[model samples]
Target: MNLFRLSKGFITEVHRLFALFWWESSDVEKRLHWGSWDKLCESKNDGGLGFCDLSLFNQAMLAKHCWRFIKWPNSLVVRVIKGRYFPTSDFLHATKCSSDSFVWKSFMWGRELIEAGSRWQIGNRSSTLIYEDRWIPRRHSFKVQSPRVLGRDAKVRLLLNTSAKEVEAILSIPTGSNLDDYLLWHFEKDGNYSLKSGYKLG
Candidate 1:
């Protein structure tokens, strides 16, 4: 006397369950159709019947992490999992499976696809160099190229400011020179200029 018993078996049971939740005839029909499970889960805008199976949706959501791991294997979450459970290898073998659940395998497959298309860039704001879509050790050190000062006055100011003592030492060279040049040279060499005294470059 299980009251829910029907000649159509599981399909009838599913339909009955849908009925209790206020689904219309069209919804029941869509759920009953033996189409691709993925298509059935999609939104109606994508041309699929909008029937969400929550358990499947949860699995799919968690499956995204698999892709994240493959994209950034050295990321914090992946690192923790690698340290705690996968210490011995980069790739997890089927036999050594810790979880061994079907959902976990599905996630791993998604990760594999992400890993195949991964690429990297190395450089600063001014320029960048691209690297292959594989896990290779980074061998080169990157540094920002010193920007060149453009205007003549700006260049003089830059030279004056950077390594001021060195510039003053160079200007102090006793080779015969013009009065203006000689006076300017002495001003810097004596380290008596107001700007030099006021600013502590370091």
Candidate 2:
């Protein structure tokens, strides 16, 4: 299967191959399908053949690519994409360009899946934004972004004072000079990705 699905058009070669294999009779003539292709793409428990939907599978795979990009931002592939589409904004906050490459557009399509399943795993608060990133377990930082509540330069480090005390903060994780903030999959512990989770999301 192509890594990028329908990046330019409606269907991919994999789908075309599937149609040929499933609907064509011996050598030449096409056979009448016993059931609708959509129905056949459902789960066996749902009274269908349990065939995998190529489109959904493709989306799931693309989403994993986005996840990998975010998980390892310094990778060559991510560096290229980020350099072009999101020089100022991070992956989750990046806006779609009017004239994006087909692959870049495809990358945009799968980004939401990664965003929905991921959260910041705070090792230290350095990279996290006090008002922007989701360092808190239940939700992202402060619900409101009022100037009166927090100054413009506010950061995750602001939660702790010089005394190393919690200054109106709920988090109490220990900080170190070498610690760095990282991402984790909210659905599971030990931070692993699963195709079942991705397909279920689709």
Task: Return the top candidate by lDDT.
Answer: 2
Pull out the clashing pairs in model 1: none
Tens-digit per-residue lDDT, 19-106, candidate 1 = 4454334633543335554466566777877665443333334434544444467888788766754577653332235565554455
Query: Against the hidden true structure, what lDDT does model 1 obtain?
Result: 0.37
lDDT of 1 at 131: 21
> Tell me, what's the RMSD of every candidate?
24.2, 7.0
Off by over 4 Å in 1: 1-19, 24-48, 91-202
Query: How many residue pairs clash per model?
Result: 0, 0
Which lDDT value does model 2 have at 58? 71
